[model samples]
Target: MASLSQLIAKPATFSVSTPRTSSGQYRPRRATVQCASSRGGERSEPDAPKHQDRRDPRRARRQCHRHPDVRASRRRRPRRDARRLLLRRRGPSAERQRATCCPPPSSAPAVDFTPPDAASLPLRTRPAAHSVTADYVAKFNAGIAAMKALPPDDPRSFSAQASVHCAYCDGSYSPEGFPGVELQVHNSWLFFPFHRCYLYFFERILGSLVGDPSFAMPFWNWDAPDGMRLPAMYADQSSQLYDPRRDGRHGTPKLIDLDYSGTEPRFTDKQQVDHNLRVMYRQMVSLSPTPSLFFGSAYRAGDDPNQGPGPLENVPHGPVHVWCGDPKQPAREDMGNFYSAGNDPLFYAHHANIDRMWSVWKGIDARRHTDLTDPDWLDASFLFYDETPQLVRIRVRDVLDTGSLRYQYQDVPLPWTAARPTVTRRADSLLAPAAQAAAAAARKAGDFPITLDEATSVTVKRPVAGKRSKAEKASEEEVLVIDGIEVDRDVAAKFDVFVNAEDHGAVGSGGRELAGSFVNVPHRHGHGRGRGRGHGKNGGGIKTKLRLALNEQLEDLKAEDDESVVVTLVPRQGKGKVKIGGVKIELMH
Candidate 1:
């Protein structure tokens, strides 16, 4: 082999030729270098003759490009001394063009984010909408009026605040570095914390307008039977809280359907109340038993938005939005759709109750049902203009504590906690042996990636049962995962999910067959007038997954030892708009 010193002295030579393009721009051409000897025992390259056209600019350029020594010598040249010469040779315009073409990709706008510290402000108690006093209603109305009076351009104005909500929920903005992917706060772990931060700033803005530092907002206590109807305050047409773009039939004195599916139920007042309580019970307790089951699927940076929604966000949460929205309008404007939801003054109260549920969920099972500890969940941040009209970036971690935010929901009776769904029917009793055998055959024959134009069912195989401790089986749950859900982003769609059910239509929360649902409130693509709300372009399709905890259901169905479970999907709204990719069951740790 050649000595190291000799190899260094006679380094391999190469050249990158700059070919002229049709646009009169020089493009660098790929150059190849070869060793002097293939075996590398000794390698050498002849030096160029020193007398051969040394002053010719083209020859000098080729020589410089070909040799490493020339490049080193160029860097060693004093920059200050050669600055004028290089500038004169290239011309300022050429240099500018080069810099422009090679501009740094890191120039994305720096977010002016500041995580807030523990608040020292006096705790503000948010009153329930139905229970608020006459004075409280007057103050809240005044605040809303003042906000509406502000110019649309003002960040603290009601319209601007509505726009903020629209932009985040709808596919208006993308995450940093992900210019094409939407920044959706719904349908994932971000749902709770993002709204908490949003409400915190909004409440602050409202209080500032009303000149009450300790002023708190009201929560629509729709979970309770007495507060199931639209709050009387929002029903008053003359009040600032009223929004014309709502279901006219679903006004005060008409109870809101917690699991509304666009069709009005024939249930009387008492029946509706009982049904609504069961829905709350199912979504909060039965369906959501673990942190992952409650918070939703993980969505990290660069990941596509709308990974999935938790049980609460799927049912009463989505159903309530659709119930309040005007059905006559295209895409269910105002309360029914994401972009126009914030336009309704009741949106805040509705969300306040939703936010309260986050706290309530933690209280239900302090050991298991807790906030997700994922760092991505904690660090996920959003930008919002505060009461001062200053852009402030808030993280999920900052709003996890309502006390730190200096606000608390009024202590009220949780009637749904006692309304836990009891097993009223069993699959074996409802499904005859023949029907059960037919279901198994259908699951075996059913194809993957089925369209949801009508009722669909496919039996998916569960994980093979292994030897596990009794404690392990009790703590760990089996989760049914419906993966690769593709749907149009602009449509309001819903489909109820059932596991091991004989008839999906007949099953309700009373049966173990009824698992949960997946729903979407239509949202416009960009900030344009499109399908759902505002003048926005249509959005690209959404691909997401749905997860349901099925431990209790498996026991009720007596399918703990069974290898496969029949999964049924019944389309209640927006049929032919959704596609299911596949289904499987996994063990939830």
Candidate 2:
């Protein structure tokens, strides 16, 4: 046997090129995920009660899952591969695999998931119902033309008359028209939903501009080595869209993998959906404080940082190709970078993944989807225009009904009772409650780090949270500026919190800091038809007593009827301990 490096240099080319599998064959490709993989550092599952048996059933699932790929290769590699060819002939997706990359033998592209290549999947020639066609650039130009035609301040200004609001508002504005900036949701957690909505509209605009009703948003998966180049728009360096860069490596517009080591490979934008869906498959049932705490960052917690998902909570699971951007003058953007809502085209695809994760999570555990009916929690209402272009008042309830309006995502695998969620043997039961309080609390911490279920992996440069004074208000934009505005940037990276700066980090209080940790509660998934909230027992039914330390004061938070009690973080300037929210007042203020 030659050395490892030598083997790679002279790797043998297959004699038959793996015998062309026909179209419609389910070719399992290597998992390609986008945005952080949904299994995103496990958070505590919604408090699954402990089993006295001291034996974890999840161990059984992992033992069972042992994907057909690993096992087949071990048991009978050649025969199993040959069988795949036969299955392809019988499958419905034989023709579509030409372009898709590196499908795993087991995680094959399913007949259902594959779309007919552009040739077979012709553009509906019958005049598009609306203006946008498949070409986003065309639609963009048209929108510019249309916008120019409209008179100034014609509700169309702001590109579509959008009203940005504090997403963390728990419905305080239901009675008062607008909450005037109800800001308890911590500025740190605000950006995720805001940009999510922003991207939603951008996609609509892109679609409208191109005249293709079926166009979807793309993503910026920078983890892969090939993704380092600048998107086409930025590549030219001639446009105002350029961003400064360093030498040939760091700023070369290439997607940088947080895990520089060569383990789990990164993916392409097109491939990451299913990869993420799988991770989301687990997350749908599992709960973690990561999404709420880190927003779009990576999440983890462990004895060895590298032993788990590492610090990059928003770990890039896919390739670097920009679905859209200034490619020529490449400069990659963080998932939670200085991304303002209105700009950025691929923003929609990024959020599409977020939305999909939401759907997956809801399906896995219905209870996980419901907001804690805590008076403060329910009082939040985020403002967003409906597809009809009317600013409809929405709350956590509104977000729950993703299918209620005009959109639905592409048909992806929806984990049914058959494909039960696995309780990873590697999970720490201790993190469940902490994870629960995390979800309940940081439902809005934009980029703050939470105890990632995988291990305590944190995203860097988190946003901050803090209150604003009445005098500091009046001049700012909305209710967040009313109650308290988020500082909007990583507190660790950019510590400036003054109100007058042109680029104020939106996450207030120097980024949201949650006071919860994960702990085991009850096993809910795969139990029965599942409750309206989850697959097992009701979330409201669980007696979740969370031990939270608001500043220095410690208190145990219990789950109310579909309500989450807000352990509001009150950060005062200068280091001083003070009592404001929650009981047991002696907290680390």
Per residue, candidate 2 scores C-alpha lDDT tens digits across 74-140 of 0111212222111101111223122111111111111111222444322321111122244543444
* TM-scores for the candidates: 0.77, 0.33
lDDT (Cα, tens digit) per residue for candidate 1, span 11-55: 111101121000000011111111111111111112323123322
Clashes of each: 6, 148
List residue ranges in candidate 1 displaced over 4 A: 1-120, 175-179, 424-427, 466-470, 508-510, 525-539
- Candidate 2 — which residues are off by over 4 angstroms? 1-253, 256-341, 364-379, 385-390, 411-589
Cα RMSD of all models vs. native, in order, equals 16.6, 26.3
Superposition TM-score, candidate 1 onto the true structure = 0.77
Q: Ten-residue segment with the worst summed lDDT in candidate 1?
A: 20-29
For candidate 1, list the clashing residue pairs, or say none. Answer: 528-534, 528-535, 528-536, 529-534, 529-535, 529-536
User: Which candidate should be chosen as best, given TM-score against the real structure?
Assistant: 1
